[model samples]
Target: MENTMTKSILKNKCLIIDGTRAFMMVWLGQMISFIGSGLTSFALGVWVFQKTGDITQYALISMFFILPGVLLGPLAGTLVDRWDRRTTMFISDLGTGLSTLSIAVVYLLGGLQVWYIYVAVFLSGAFGSLRMPSMQAAMTMMIPKKSLGRTSGLMEIVQIGQFLIAPIVAGGLMESIGLAGIVMIDFSTFLIAISILLFIHIPRATVTAEGCAGQGTVLQEAVYGWKYIKARPGLAALMVLFAFTNFTTEMTVVLFTPLILSFASTAKLGLAMSLCSSGFLVGGLLMSIWGGPKRRVPLMMILMILLGVFSTMIGLRASVGLIVVSGFLATLTVPIISSSNQVIWQKKVAVDVQGRVFAIRRTITLATPLVTYAIAGPLSDLVFEPLMTVNGALAGSFGQVLGMGPGRGIGLLFVCMGLLTTLVTAIGCLSPRLRKVEEELPDAVITQSAQVKIEKKLPSLLPARSPRNKIVYAKCHDLKPPLPELLSRD
Candidate 1:
């Protein structure tokens, strides 16, 4: 079975050259769409806050945006595998575009309400659930195995742009274009994305026996990803590590705005955010060029530890400079860590089931943010703030170190979350299963091929007079041992 699989893979490898061009076309369209989406998201948040003057209401907009994707991810991913990936992307973009268009029309008609925005956001999220996993799975097919890391880094560049450029542009545009105009721009980008995808072809995964077995129902197929992960202890451990890491990071994310605002003006907060976002841009560029460390697991763990350290530093001082520096350093690690982790998944998971597997991974990893966001506010107001107050119980010890006052409580919370993140990373690093994941998990895509020698007489099988071809084909005696045996020898 192994030999047969190896030979099959070798034959198909000739069909897939380095897919840099194809990947970039799709990536460029998606990046443009993401920036447009970000513009609308920032504009909407500002609009909602302006109208209601309630942080909770503003926060709920984000909640609505995430909830649908989180709830429907498994189903969406299953469908992504079942359907043509390019078609899935087209439908997702079209649906999201329509949702954004509805918001624009509603606003124009003066019938726009908070509930309507929520509904549109929910619909966009549902479509995104389908779009993201399908795109990821398609990437594995489009790019050569060796280039996945660099491809992930390039992908990060698109993501970083949303945080780095979108807000500033959106803030400026709101003064001239207004919310309706901003949403229309977002809709237009979606149309562009759909148009780009229409010209592309994304290959479908070849269903294996295991994949076919789970296709009895969508629910069964959805659960298949989890089962697949469960069977791989190393992969399961990696997921758990990321889940805890994501939770800690998200808790810090929840507190960052309030923490910065407690001491600095809104202008300074924006500057700090921009500076932090630049870190992602820088990190992504570096990863794209350098392709990260060869040993991805170790690099990921180290980056996590660095992230924890920088996160802790953000709360050590209330100064704007300190926050800026710490925030930048903390965010700088994000792209590298994310890309490194993605490379591991791309290498380990089979392309056929990556959609479902990545979907489950996304669902599990993102669940933490929802929980953290729900509790962060109450925890700060009721528990941490009081404890960090001047007259509170811990005032003499912890309060003296972290300081007491407006944002002090959130600062202390940052410290605790940072420590938790560091400890989790340390534990993950020490675990043998996680530490040796690369060795334990065989590469799903074979990079090396067996050397074959074909006689000049076999002109039909061997390309005649091809100097560009690097494959060395020998006489029949050299190839008779089976390709797998030759590959093993090499």
Candidate 2:
């Protein structure tokens, strides 16, 4: 028994050391790949807009990019679980690189069409759906559960790099090297990403009896993801919370560019974007070092409320200074909120099933953005903007506070969305299930041996109980009063 315990402790210590090194090595390569993909995205958006001079056409590109991922998410996740994670990521990167190369080839041949771009981007998105869930699930094995929050924080820094560096670099390169050159650079980055994955060893999730029982046809596995979440009420409620939050956030995102352009120049917009993304960079750095509060759910809720307040502040004025401050603060909250929430899911959900569960969660939450995108433009053009005009009805009442001018109506919409986000978060906090999620759901990765020892020791440490009051507990850490004792208190 002592030898077994000694081996377990030593094993855990080694994992603590090796896991950080392995995760960081892979993370560095993915960071390079993210920057490259961002450059391509920026360059392509510019190319499309310059070609057609229509905002709708440019927007369609984003729609095409996201639609495939959402539609194929469940099936892709099932495949992710079935395949080796490193191999899955390698294939995804290779396919996306090929797609990018094809675009460059088309452009070089003077045969590049809008349809060609759509098809290529859609293919890339489909592959991305496979890569992301695989990567996320693999991380659960690569990093210790205790470090998941910090690891997510590091991942957030990569996103900040993409957002902060890509556009500026892509804009400069477009003038000197042009579209083909930029795309070729992106392809090179993919090669780097693939090469790193080839050299690294990522441990796979241990398939339990429950996981095996659910495996069958691809369709059954895909459907199993939904059923799994349905069985876990806490996880289901969390997904719904994010879906509503994403819907409101997307409405703000779709309108943000136009809102700035209405009163500010492109140069000012660029500066504002840089400032905003820097907040993410700083927030990520802090979270990586500090981790977060021990009780992460409450921290996440507080950050969500802060985000809502910042979102409202963003639309309170047309002044560039206010927007810059608000945008920076709003973006700053994202990494912490995301990191906290990710850790909750990582610790609670079994890693073997994470690929499917996370994918379904992604699919459902992302669906709201599509709906929000579809409605945002029409709502702004026909309803909000018209209502905020100087001569319009609301101009005399609400418009006075928001100001009667261009983009002011959109400002009103921003305020409404922000308040909705805040209200939803507030209400969600009141739900006992959500508030007690960490207490109710057992940690899926707890060492079975350790749990057994705890269970054996627990009864001796507590008061004697009647036969009817005794309960078999799977999660020893969550020991609490008997059900009748709790019900009597209620």
Candidate 3:
């Protein structure tokens, strides 16, 4: 029976959700929902900016949107594994949609305010925090190990694709249908996402020793992910890498537009963002078709270097077209880096443990964005911006060539950021620990007899005999002494 269950999982290549189908279905849902959500988010940013005319205050909305999820990371990941995957996704979509619908109601009632938007964004963040890990674990379980990298690439594409189109669409939608209309469309997308999840099936993960007889309470289960990470160096290193990358990107994001807009206009900003988005989309398409090479880490390292190069170029010239070209180049490297990371996690960890492990992974890594939110703006606006200007300290020596002005202030920030990114990747490559992480890590290979063999072998290894099979345990364990006397003494 154990063998049968294992074979069933491995053999299917069709039937709507035999792993491969599950990937496509989930991908489609994510693709639609992401674009719609991006549209609403951009529109909200514009609405708040127009109303308040304060960049800091407007930027505060993003904080309200993602912080709750970071706070709720552990709880969300644990509960996702306990609950049904489809139901988890459905509840997430439905709850988030309801939240969006409430904001639309405020607009209808003529009682909308900035505070209301903050509240809505916070609630949406909380729901979404749970939704992401559940989806990650589900897909990991659903896909075969060999195809993991391409799937990871495909996910990055879907994620970045919306960012590419959402702003442009939102900008246009704002002109025609207004903010309220845009949100209404967002609400509809949530409903659509829920419907798509309904048509698919995700296999239930086998309960583990951690969740079974030696079971943890909810809090312990939440920390199960942390415990998993502590045991694996590969995952730990990846977490650190993501933290820095997230923080650096956040800073670059702050400087990128200011530097570009100085040479070009705000319209040019949209074009640059679109070009970046295209790079990711093309990478995803490549990943989906070709998958990745057998060795995942090398690809990741190369992509990181590519990203660093493009990042430096953004700092080199204030030319709008040049910066926009760099943006395209910058985005091209993302899918490669992201897919490699995902493939590593999926291959190294057990499918059953992924919910807690990946969730904790997200908890640690995702929090870096908040760090970006905390540091990027201030560093650019205060230290970097001021120091590079004509009257600032560095002006006398190099500021003349570097230029000593408002935009040049941000140029200093970009150069420093590009150098930091390159150095981090270089250090990562130099470390034998990170470079051969796969060699040190466990690879989860699903052999043809995987399930039955593991099950049969486990009882022999355990001291106690289960009620269902004392005779079978005796045979499996090859008992040399009488078991009944030992059982009575125990």
Candidate 4:
């Protein structure tokens, strides 16, 4: 009996470790594909700006990238839950690749038009939306509960690598091999990602009462994610805060390229962007090593406030050096903020319902950015740009302080965005519900011991549903009432 028990424990440990291995495998393929897509994206941004010489048209690309994701997120999330996550990711990658290939073909044959690029971007975004929730849900299945923060940080590294490397390389490649070659490379990356998915297996989430409650017709299931969030005031408030921050971030993103290109050459723009984006890599590495602080809310809020301060610095001067330094500082806070927030949701929400819940969370937060992208260009070109010119209205006051010129108006806008972001973050920090959310919410993640017990057929030791119909998993860290006392109550 002793030997049998030991064997059971060993088997469970192997299964848990295998899940981590699977996660790394999937992550590798995605990382490669991310770099490839970044190349195409950077090349296209340069191409569009050069072609039209219009910030409004350049901003349209970002708007299209976000619009479909915000619009279709709920439906995509429901579908992710209903379907196999691995398969959904597979299809999503394939569809996005096809869209990219279409752009390459159009460019080669009939000569690519601006409208063609927009159509391709729209189709790509529509397909890419399905990948986000599915990937997050898959991560929950593959990663241990305690390691979610580190893993999220690791994921950020992929994003950082894409941004840090792609711009510098794409700028050079565009002059040599050209955009067509870049697009084909991106399509090949999709194939590599799908091939990896074909080999690896992602575990299905265990059905809980929360997951069951969310099960219904398509429309009903889609709406249930919103209801789930509404019931948790902390999560709802967190999402609202994210929406506001995302708005400010998008406003900056739409303007950054134009801001740099205004007073500098394309080569300098690439160099400045590459230098700034390196901060993302550094932050990701730090988070991966340290796994963030224990009190995540305070850390997140503090970083957000710092992010605002950095944004203000970006537009204080027209120098590339200033923009590089400020941009780097601003991006440094992003991965830390994102990883902490992601870990909170991972810990609090049940795995089975994560797809729908994460989907809705994404939709709400991203909705703000859609509006930001749509209006940022016109606002910069028409309103802000005109106000800070040499003979413009605000030239005597605000322009004197910020310096009057082509990009100075946009610089003034950045100062306003930075101030607003800081103010909003400060207000969010004061919310007791948001601040003390960790104390209020019980951990929904299943423990390794719980998994072991379930596999060993110790039904009596398994978790039970709480009065609130929540699964009361035995978290090893909840020591106040003692593990046995908590389990007994459940």
Minimum summed lDDT over a 10-residue window in model 2 is located at: 463-472
Steric clash pairs (candidate 3) = none
lDDT of 4 by residue, 58-77 (tens): 76887788788888999988
For candidate 2, list the clashing residue pairs, or say none: none
Candidate-wise lDDT, in order: 0.81, 0.80, 0.73, 0.82
Q: Count the backbone clashes (under 3 Å) in each candidate.
A: 6, 0, 0, 0
Better of 1 and 4 by lDDT: 4
Please provide TM-scores, in order, for all candidate models, with all chains considered together.
0.88, 0.87, 0.87, 0.86
In order, what is each prediction's RMSD in angstroms? 7.4, 8.8, 7.0, 6.9
| Decoy 1 TM-score against native | 0.88
What C-alpha lDDT, on a 0 to 100 scale, does residue 16 get in candidate 1? Answer: 30
* lDDT (Cα) of model 1: 0.81
lDDT tens digits by residue: candidate 3, 1-490:
2232234433443433445786688788878888889989998899999999998878889889878777888888877877766567777888888888898899989999999999999999888877877787777767777777778878887787568878878988999999899999999888788767655666555333333421368888787778778766667777787778767766787667778776677777777777766887887778877788888788788788778778877776667777767877887777777777888887776655676777787877768878877887787778877887778987875587667877777877777777788888888887777788888875753422443444454454443232211122123224323222222342
Q: After superposition, how far is residue 79 of candidate 4 from its true place, in Å?
A: 1.4
| Candidate 1 stretches greater than 4 Å from native | 1-18, 446-490
Worst 10-residue lDDT window for candidate 4 reads 466-475
**Per-residue lDDT value at 129 in model 3:** 79
Put the candidates in TM-score order, highest first. Answer: 1, 2, 3, 4
Q: Tens digit of lDDT per residue, candidate 2, span 237-347? A: 788888898898779878888889989999998888889878898889889998888788888888898889999988888988999999899888989988788788878
Q: Which is the better candidate, 3 or 4, if ranked by lDDT?
A: 4
lDDT of model 2 at position 414: 92
| Candidate 4 backbone overlaps, count | 0
> Where does candidate 2 stray beyond 4 Å?
1-18, 446-490
